[model samples]
Target: MNRTKILYSAAAFIAFSFLAGVTLQHATAEFVPEWVKNTAKWYGEGKTSEVEFVNAIKYLIENNIIVLELDQKKTESKTSPTFENIIIPNGNSKVGNVGFYIPLNLEIEKGTTVVWINDDNIEHTVQSQDEKGNLISLFNSDLLRTGERFAHKFNDDGAYHYFCTIHPWRVGVVTVS
Candidate 1:
């Protein structure tokens, strides 16, 4: 083949490969992946701030669309006690649909420490209460920001109801047995 034709073919192949890679990178979840890609693009174009870019990535990771690898040795703590974790997902502010705490109902054994992790961009509170709206002093997290965590040990056997003060509609229950 002619040198010019060969060069053109090579360029086309490179362009196709680049486009394919980009397409695959943003092909996971329907709306979230696209939103993440656009957020990154906007950040690169200076249309968005660094905070927004980082938050978008966090959202993606929290939603399981993206998985990050961390040094397990550094993250592991020998003194840390293992607890049952519940995630306060993003979009919990919404009235219906996917806006609520994951595993609305949880059951754990007595002496188990229940940990609530805030995976949303907005702040949330893990306030323990009863069915009649009476507050429980056993455990109450005032305000948890994104990536923050709150934990409480269930020493007794009973049903503990909790809710987010910011969005009372987002409620959950933990039964200790």
Candidate 2:
């Protein structure tokens, strides 16, 4: 083939590839699904007493719970409230010094920070999940021994879900408003 023809073909290919990549990068992807929005509206706004709220939390766990980040923000000991936030201790029922579980249905104000301390003897993972229990993101600590801690700041106003990658059953939720 002629050198000019070959060079033109190569240039065209490179241009097309660059444009395709740019288009994909600029595309907007939806985070939460429509059904999840409907469900959140139904329950979050629904009038229910404390008992019902607890039950609803349980129900949400039974159904939609996704794991995102894993084992993130491990602390040394149960330290003082570093910032304005809430603490959820791991349940005693957990075997081998289990870590705490945060409900995926919290109503947190924007700019609020939340921390989770692992009082268990063993290590635990902190992960975030999608509405359908899909692993969205995760972070891990080598071993969050007794008094270990993890903290995260929520800046956006939306529902964030998280779980333990080591123990998928262990889950938590953060709602920023």
- Maximum-TM-score candidate: 1
Tens-place lDDT digits, model 2, residues 1-177: 445434433343334335433221221113323343343334444533434434433343344332222223444444444344334464622646444453335677776667767755556666667889887644333445557777777778777777766667766677777
Between which residue pairs do clashes occur in model 1? none
Candidate 1 TM-score versus the reference: 0.52
C-alpha-based local distance difference test score of model 2? 0.51
Which RMSD does model 1 reach against the true structure? 20.1
Give the residue spans of candidate 1 off by over 4 A: 1-81
Q: What is the C-alpha lDDT of each candidate?
A: 0.72, 0.51
Model 2 RMSD to the real structure?
Answer: 25.8
List the candidate 2 regions with Cα displacement exceeding 4 Å.
Answer: 1-105, 138-143
Q: Residue-wise lDDT of candidate 1 within 1-177, one digit each (tens)?
A: 445434433343334345434222332444355565666656666688868766775676577665444445666754465489999888877787586677788889877898899998889999988888667776899699999999999888888999887788777999988
Count clashing residue pairs per candidate: 0, 32
